[model samples]
Target chain A: MAESTEVKLLGLWPSTYALRARIALNIKQVNYAFLEENLGAKSELLLKSNPVHMKVPVLLHGDKPICESLIIVQYIDDVWTSGPSMPPSHPYDRAIARFWAAYIDEKWGPTTKAIDAVIVAGEGEEAKKAAVDKVYDILVLLEEAFKKCSKGKAFFGGDRMGYLDMAFGSCLGWLRFREKLHDIKLLDPAKTPQLVKWAERFCEHPAVVGVMPETEQLATIEYGKGLIAKVRGANPSKW
Target chain B: MAESTEVKLLGLWPSTYALRARIALNIKQVNYAFLEENLGAKSELLLKSNPVHMKVPVLLHGDKPICESLIIVQYIDDVWTSGPSMPPSHPYDRAIARFWAAYIDEKWGPTTKAIDAVIVAGEGEEAKKAAVDKVYDILVLLEEAFKKCSKGKAFFGGDRMGYLDMAFGSCLGWLRFREKLHDIKLLDPAKTPQLVKWAERFCEHPAVVGVMPETEQLATIEYGKGLIAKVRGANPSKW
Candidate 1:
């Protein structure tokens, strides 16, 4: 990585999207200034940088604020030439990486949101069961992708951690946090053994160890506590 | 580009997403077998290629299936080492291109869907008015981005018709067609002169000319006709 490149990351501490950028930066060994944003009272810099989305995980390379987590991750990989590259050099390989990374961005949002809403904040049993089924369906698709697409490699980016790995790895802890908080296990060992193993490897990866916040700490945060309260507030009769 | 490469695109004739892929291939001068998919009844290849989305605009390069329009466009640019690159060579430039291209993809869907449901398929005047306001808001954002980001350049991808240009260029015609069919003029010259000029330039660009389907032809298609019927069927008092 080029030294003296002034890099700053504006992020919400527990955000998976923000985590994606952080993990990418850590993997690349790029030194960056981290600004934790109060999403409730978003900063002016955040609004100006994004303008379109006004969301965080916005990367400030000097004055250019790169919005979107996955986009920022790609930007990081491209700008920083050291460490293992995120996407493979081959065009086709890059496409595959882009495809799965995009998939992670697209799928993770709705899948987790459904789980959060119906399982964490839901009022009834039927909705929770339906949400569980929906989440499981998403997990099954991912599990199959890992089985078939990984080609027996440890990570989606191949033997080493890459863009796809970072994309999922950032959220893996959040998934666990949700599971522990809500007492619901979506990534069952038998059903998604490959993903579970990948999760283990991702959690233990040196690049991610210091970067990723602990689940217990995350669970105690305002966002996580809110989710816990929602889960607990569900009708006792349904339970 | 690369000759003798077995490139095939599974696409819907009138889909803007599919159009994005087609225009990219055309720009690259890659010989692709365009398999028109009946979105009403998608083909097996389409299903197999994109089991997750089960949508059109799936590119099959040899045996590998690349799904998602923007991703496919990037893949085409990467795989075929000829013509102008979709993303610029500089990392920051590439990031900007990727950011805008993504912005177009994310914004276009909901904006058009709102227009389709309210101004076209709507039964009330108030709803139609509200939808028009919403659509205008989306257009204004794009207009602002073009004015500020492009820096008086011809396209979003800078001076040349790059990835961001292709991303928006592919869908620009659809917006025009919708405007004409629905009798609403959102892309007014006065309100969005830069985008209006860019649209004309996009339509006339050699890279896009042969690839883009005629607006008249597009308006006569089953999908286009359905939209027209909805608009016409809407309360005349609103008109």
Candidate 2:
């Protein structure tokens, strides 16, 4: 029946958002066709499927398209019920999971983008340090969340991987790659041991290993050059 | 029995985000004690409850504080089974409701903030016109969403007041007030008939009237003066 129902994912290869949905599907053990999008030349299917955002990754399940990577992950968990639940069963726990997921999407993304600007822009040394400090403050906030909520478990979702873990997992590769590129570790082992450990366990997990791109693959010199150029073009003042 | 459960709402009177939660609780017919917050002198409860955003409206249900307006709205709906479901029952429909809610929170808020900057910032006449045009474009996208998903219903969730309706409803009073303040009708009758109609229906909604602040109240000269000062203070460059 699962095979009979068509499940397809429209995504760009390098997108952290797309990787999030892939990780969820991996956990759910659902068979899905993956269509890589050429972001520069968006396909007709991609445009039609997600006209609002016109961006990947879009999940097409039985012909109905669900946009937004986190939403898609939730949808996969809801529809394919055979696997362990992605969000916890209890209502309050579910709300907590959703809350953190939102924080990751809303807060973490912008903070990282600000960090990216500082990294890519050819700025003064002091300015760069100040910018990096601002990002560290944001990281500290997440570290606090992990400490308060994780309940001393191996993952944010406890012993098994759940939505919060996947939410952060989606960004792990990009975070690690950027850290290496900048030669500064944002998720410092000494400062944020729990998150570092969580990242290590997540990357090595069988469910994630099959889908996540290698840190080296994402941290290429070519990628850094392209990112710097794009960031420079977007915010010329900083550069 | 409801009163005994210790239901409370921490909110600011001028805040549309806070108003969203009040409207939801009003819709659910839940009896909640309203604790008006002094944002400048944030109460210990407000700080303790929502340290992340430290903003209202925070819903205290049986001593558990749920932060974020939309999240609080959803929590009220989920917890209060006696009232009608705020979101649709079907999983896909629920996702659709959430998608639009996300749009309102993410896209609509920023667009309006940009519009606010042009209006209050003493920007050049041409710049103000261009900013208004951008807002109109954003409104058109929402109008398209209404056209596609609402299925010829009065509300986004169909016959009843659902999450999306309230999400927009919370902002409707402010939208109208701001339009009047700037002397530009964003929900122009000719262009956005549906949203205009939705706004009218929403205000008159019995479920909302008790909770929604009067348009005149929000449009007061004093209110406008305070807003101008606040906006100017936040974005000094624009002013």
Candidate 3:
């Protein structure tokens, strides 16, 4: 109870990264006040807390702020040792979890951003379809990873949701949103049956329910639309 | 002793990432076989060890292979608990160490690469000078980080060469090479006096003494030149 005091989370509702911090906090059952930051006019606390990246989900535990979603998640798991461990117990398992989390950020994250860029820019169908295909290809790799990591368990954390689960699961809302907007099935059952099934259980978890922003609601938000529009107008090569 | 058995490192001598694994092993006093890989014709061992990135600096502990330099370093530290801890002990300190290490990779790493592109491409004085300036600017930020992390101590790890030191120190050879090749003082003592001193001590440390490739020798290597040449020829936007 002493550790939970003064816990605050600086986040944007539509950010998958922010969702990660929220999910981790919820999983740990730590009481925290969520401080939503406006990307357009960021609060001083947000900017000061994360001066390096100036990006959100900054978890403020007392006066100290931990930035970077995955890092924050790890910090939560480290300090809140009372809860079900978010990171795997073994060193090698932890390494593998770190590897895939990095892959998701470096590879899958960019592909999704590229898809957003293409769709928002109203690019030709070929370009949009190609972007979607790339996502599926990456998902196939993730599916294999899930198989290896889960070892026939229900979650990536085996009996319960853990680090890798939170890492990938945060993107479920975006995947759902993209699927509806583009009229495409991203988590194709055939290609990623394991992930598709895992995703369902993930979203339905008590820790996750009502946490993710609704896909329909997300699509209507100017924040989401404006963010995508900004990416669309950015240098295409960046995507 | 059991964990040390069958330990092997797949690496390229010139690579800073590979250098990290070497330094960690040296510090931990772990006996390991160094298997040099030809980047032009990568060994099947490395190809299979890191199928995802197909990159150098894979640490094989028995049959399991650990990829990613930082992850490998952490894994080495985690397994060899007998040695001086590489990562900071306190959870918050560990988070700070990780944050700065990541900054080194994502930000400082790219700036250095861009400088290599400009210098290798034989770009004009203005372009090269701008690249060098960018590097110095990053150094200034790192200098600030050094001050805060070291707390007036000798190294980023305080009393000993630890994670952040290893992360940034691995690049010393490249920094030295670039300085000599470009006839520029990249780590200006005036701007980063603490880092300049820290760099000297880091290089001279018993664990680090011969692990880093000599700048003069690195400069003469075809491997180094060819790698920079490839970068020079790549799309400028990538730099």
Candidate 4:
């Protein structure tokens, strides 16, 4: 470990992005100091470190802050360098994985925004329907991604966990809980069977299983629910 | 040249993303075949190559297809194997560059979709107002990114023509057209003087200047105006 330096994770406990970083750290078997931040009352350290977004899963190497989970995961894979790698070999395969990873992050905003607006605040039908449609569209895209990326695999990287899986896998954790609490399953193993199957597989992995929130952890998601409700209420059309 | 392979670019000449890949190739001095696709009726080659997105700027290396402009630029940088790298030395700085890239991509959708829907179609007060707000917000974010990533640099990745600049520069080109068509001035040199200054510097680079569509090429974008209007009308609320 001659080249290794101290790696630290700056994150909130419940952030899906943060969870992705945690899972990557676990998979890479890299040691890190975890600093949890209250997203409401942002820490000076977090703000100074990631001033642009002023948010986390900021992975710090020495004093440098790597904001954005996907970038941080890539950093971990590249710098500390490890496990199965964030991207698979074969440039085409890697490109496919990157596409899905970005797609998930993009579509997640509106999809979940609509869900929370409906469940908590009960927003406009037009806005809600539009949001849900975006969600389903992304799911369809996800199904296609899984088909292409998962080539006889136990994971997205094929045979082992990769950075794309870590980014996507952690994000899905809240969906089932959201469905159960709201009485609507997004990935009905019946409809999006491939996506559901992928989730199931990810949940079983050694690194993922331990890092993921238990169903119980989601039961009292008061702050998260409130934030989503507020976000939707503030910008229904935007959602 | 043990790892050398044939390169080909499948892109629409007018597309903002396509310009990104073209600039990369021009700078790297990588020779490749260029196939301009009919976006309305996508070619079998483009569709087969990038089946998932089915979008343009699909750069195929040998047989491996790389979709998404930023991803394609990265693949080009990677496969070229040796060059003045697009991303700079520090991982944190690279993450900052990436965060800004993703932010612009995320924000551009809502802003451009809203504007293109109403402004181009020549329709609706409410939509127009909303579109204004969206674009304004993106400019603010760009302002901040320019402020944060600025290190007395010619581009977003600091000294070189990096991924973030390549990612945003496409829109910067379009922004000029948008201003001319809609009478909306974004990235105002006076307001976001830093970003506008950077764009000026980027445009001066001989490599960047060579590949980008000339003033005449952009003047003939009446077809693009129609296509964007159609897509925006179909999904007005998608933004």
On lDDT, the candidate that comes out on top is 3
Off by over 4 Å in 2: A1-3, A227-239, B1-4, B121-126, B220-223, B227-239
Query: Candidate 4: which docking quality band?
Result: medium
Each prediction's TM-score versus the true structure? 0.92, 0.89, 0.92, 0.78
Q: What lDDT score belongs to each candidate, Candidate 1 first?
A: 0.80, 0.78, 0.86, 0.74
Residue range with the least summed lDDT across 10 consecutive positions in model 3 chain A: A230-239
Interface RMSD of 3: 0.6
lDDT of 1 by residue, A34-150 (tens): 999998899999999988788988999987778888888888988887866788777777787777778777777787778678765445788877877777887887788677556
* Candidate 2 residue lDDT tens string, B1-239: 34468899999776888888888888878887899998679999999998888888888888778888887887777777675688876668777877888888877777776777776677767887898888788778778767766779988877788888877778877777667555578988788889888888988988777667765677454655676565556653442
Cα RMSDs, all models:
2.9, 4.7, 4.7, 6.7
Model 2 per-residue lDDT at A137: 78
Expressed as tens digits, the lDDT of each residue in A50-137 for candidate 4 is: 8767888888787777888888887777666545567886666777788778777867766776667664556666665665666777
- Per-prediction count of colliding residue pairs? 0, 0, 0, 1
On residues B1-239, what C-alpha lDDT tens digit does candidate 3 reach at each position? 43647899999888999999999999888889999999889999999999989999999999899999999999989888985688888788888999999989998778977877886677878998899888888899889989988888999999978999999999999898777655689888888899999999999999888778997678567966665455545642332
Pairs of colliding residues, candidate 4? A86-A163
Per-residue alpha-carbon lDDT of model 3 for A135-233, expressed as tens digits? 998999999999988889998888889999999999999888777656689999988999999999999998899888888678567955665446545
Which prediction has the highest DockQ against the true structure?
1
Minimum summed lDDT over a 10-residue window in model 2 chain B is located at B230-239
Q: Model 3, DockQ value?
A: 0.78
Ranking of models by TM-score:
1, 3, 2, 4
